[model samples]
Target chain A: MKENNSFILGIKHGIPICLGYLSVSFAFGIFAVGSGLSVIEALLISMFNLTSAGQLAAVPIITGGGGIPELALAQLIINLRYSLMSVTLSQKLGKTVSALDRFWIGFGITDEIFAVSTSKNKSVGRKYMFGLILTPYAGWSLGTLLGSVAGNILPDSVSSALGIAIYGMFIAIVLPTVKKHLPTALCVVGAIAIGCAFKYIPMLSRVPDGFVIIIAAVVASMVAALLSPVSDEESEQTDEKEVNTDA
Target chain B: MPSMNFFFHLGVMAGITYLVRMLPLVLVNKKIRNRFLLSFLYYVPYAVLSVMTVPAIFYATSSPWSALAGFVIAMILAFFEKSLLTVAIFSSAAVFVTEFLLPIIQ
Candidate 1:
């Protein structure tokens, strides 16, 4: 009975997240179809990989006929943050979670979900975690289905306009943090500078999109990390502030 | 057609993504003590998102001008710390309106 209550609470907490994902995933679905994927193909990608940025990066590689190593490496670079979130989350798991349960719960560790779960005052249990994941998963998959169908039917002009929606979402994700954090601001500027060089310079323009993204991200992040390594005390304070703001 | 079958690519993407999330949760019972690694991980998302957004964003729409309009709107709203959904929808609207007006203006 107690487990059931937490599960219900989790679903209730997930409603706003579901609504937010619907629009973002819809844009993704249209973008994927515009990039040459069939509607079903777009839907499949969203269903299998419940990541916005990772899926955004993956679609280009997939359609461009990128190799397995390229795909794997891109996924690693794009989703590496999840590994860190999972580590932090593991410490917050309630005693009800068993070894096998950890594997299943691991699948739902998106940035939003992690924030919601961690923001709670108490440790989260397996049932609550599953409940939290279920609603957003459905929202994400359903939104893709709607958007993919819309992409096929919508006129070219409108669909083309929708193409910028994802990038707008990307900007929304990065800019607020950049505004507050100097290292992060420099990281964005550095990455953008590298990105432009690869796009414009004749010799560097020869590099594939996958490798260019990887190189810019890795190099910029490495430089930022080296320049101002965050100590444990500062990291914890930031985490608390993030959770507080999230709540 | 892709060099390999589509399922193969899907498998690789899904497999690698899942493994990265799963390994840490299942194996790591303690807080990560490595500072540089943590900082690098902290900065990765911002760097990756920035690299992907610029240059590419300017080309996302039919007109680079419209894309720029949307990008500017998104950056402004985001600087004020608007919600993700709000920023995304308004930016798309900005693009739609800008694209509509461009042909007439020219």
Candidate 2:
């Protein structure tokens, strides 16, 4: 019964994430193909990367004949947050999960997946985690393939409108959290300040956009964590109950 | 058909991406037992989201003045806890109208 509940919860949580992934991946697919990649190549990239920003950043670089080192560096810088996320999620998994399960779970760790999974009860089992990953994984890949193929047929106006969907999904994720958390509010201000600073500062404005996000995330998270540590009581109250129903 | 170069590039990207994502899960699964680290992870998503979103509100426009108008409108709507879809649409619309009408009126 407990297992069933977790499975259901995973599916439920995946719904909004899947919707967002579809729209975003669709746009990515269209843009990628339009940028000169074939439909199959676009599909494969989206399937493996499953990251919007990382792929978007790579598109121009790849098309421009940027070296492998440059592409790898850009992806690494943009995706460094996943390392922090994996460390946190590791604790939530406790000591029960096997290395194999962790392997699969890590493959699905996108910004959306990390956000949704981390927001859930910590004692969630590997089975549910699998469910969450599987649904969105399919949605994102399929959306990419379809969008890439559709790019040839779709009108330019429609494709451009779909491009905006990714930004809309991003805003959706941020708004609800800022409404609830003061530290989050501070982080938002810090991010905007950092973004503006990077844009306007004489030397900084020349840095790549992907690096800016990584720098902003690390600086803002560190500052917010230092300024407002999570209280012991709140942590305890939010402690997820571990139900060992697998046996 | 896609060029061989495109396929090779795509394959390289896929390999690199999978490694970055998979490395932490494998490494940390064996070593991480710190409670402080766990708490830090809990807040990372919100921080990352904010970092990604706030800049878009301003950068969505072509000109500084138009972006300023969009930012003002977006902030007001966001303060009221409007849906992000609503805020983005209204703000983009605000930029378009402001930029479009400014010229006509002037």
Candidate 3:
């Protein structure tokens, strides 16, 4: 009964993620089809990969006649955050979780999934994670299929307008956190400075987009973490407990 | 006009993508606890996001000057803690208007 309740909670929590994924994946599908991919091909890509940024980045590389190595490197750099997310989540899951469960859960470690999962109380278990993954996975895959089929039906202007949705989503993700954390605000400024420098400086401008992103992220994160060290007293208080399971 | 090769290319892309996604999971041991590493990991997403979004403020526009105007509008909206949807629409509209009106005025 407890397991069933956890599973239900997972599904309920996944609702917002599913809705967001549907809209974004639909846009991606339309863009992919507009870029000359067929419906099946687009749907297949979204289904298997489920990474909007990587997909967007890959689309241009593929179309621009970039080689396989270029595509792989671009994707590696763009989605490297997933590696961090996976590691943090594994620690959160702890010892009792089976290997097979970890395998399946690892597959669903997208930004939204990690956000929702980590935000949950420690009491939440693998069942809940599985349920959360199910709905968004379906929404993303199906939305891509639908959008691919519906491509070119909409006016180019409207399609171009919809291009802002992903940016809107990014703003939604970052703004709230930045408002609460001064370090985050500093990181944002640092990123802007670094990005602008890369764009304008002749030496940095020669660097590839993927490499630039990786470098900027690493440097900004390092600086932010260094400048705002967490207080040891607060860390000690939190570390005393195994996991705060209270929701 | 997607050719059969398109599907083949996508398949290759998917394979490569999955390999990248699966690597850290297979490699990173769950028991390892490095405070410095964890702290670094915590801020990565935010840094990556800022890096990605900051450039788009300029790249999305037709000209750098016009994009700067739009970016100013965005920064103002962001400073005031405006809604994301509102900020996005306002910033893009600012760019569109700037791009549209600048030539006429000049």
lDDT of every model, 2 decimals? 0.85, 0.65, 0.66
Q: Score the docking of each candidate (DockQ).
A: 0.73, 0.33, 0.37
lDDT of 2 by residue, A21-120 (tens): 6766876787777667778878878877887767876776677776676677667756665776676666666444577878778888876666566655
C-alpha RMSD by candidate, in order: 2.6, 6.1, 5.5
Better of 1 and 3 by TM-score: 1
Q: Which one wins on DockQ?
A: 1
- i-RMSD per candidate, Å: 1.7, 5.5, 4.5
- Please give the lDDT score at residue A146 for candidate 1: 91
TM-score of chain B of 1: 0.92
Comparing 1 and 2 on lDDT, the stronger one: 1
Indicate the residue-level lDDT of A84 in model 3.
66
Q: What would the per-residue lDDT of candidate 3 be over residues A69-134, giving only the tens digit for each residue?
A: 666766676677677667656656644457767767767878767766665456347778878889
Candidate 3 CAPRI grade: acceptable
Off by over 4 Å in 1: A1-5, A231-247, B1-4
Off by over 4 Å in 3: A1-7, A30-41, A91-97, A122-127, A146-151, A229-247, B1-32, B61-106
Clashes within 3 Å, all models in order: 0, 0, 0
Give the clashing residue pairs of candidate 2, or none: none
Question: Which 10-residue span in candidate 3 chain A carries the lowest summed lDDT?
Answer: A238-247
Q: Write the per-residue lDDT of candidate 1 for residues A1-247, one digit (tens) a residue.
A: 1222288888987777787788889999998888888888888888888998899898889899878888899999999999999999998898899999998888888888887887656888887898889988999999999988999999888887888888887887788777877988999999999999999999999887877888999999999999989766655555544333323
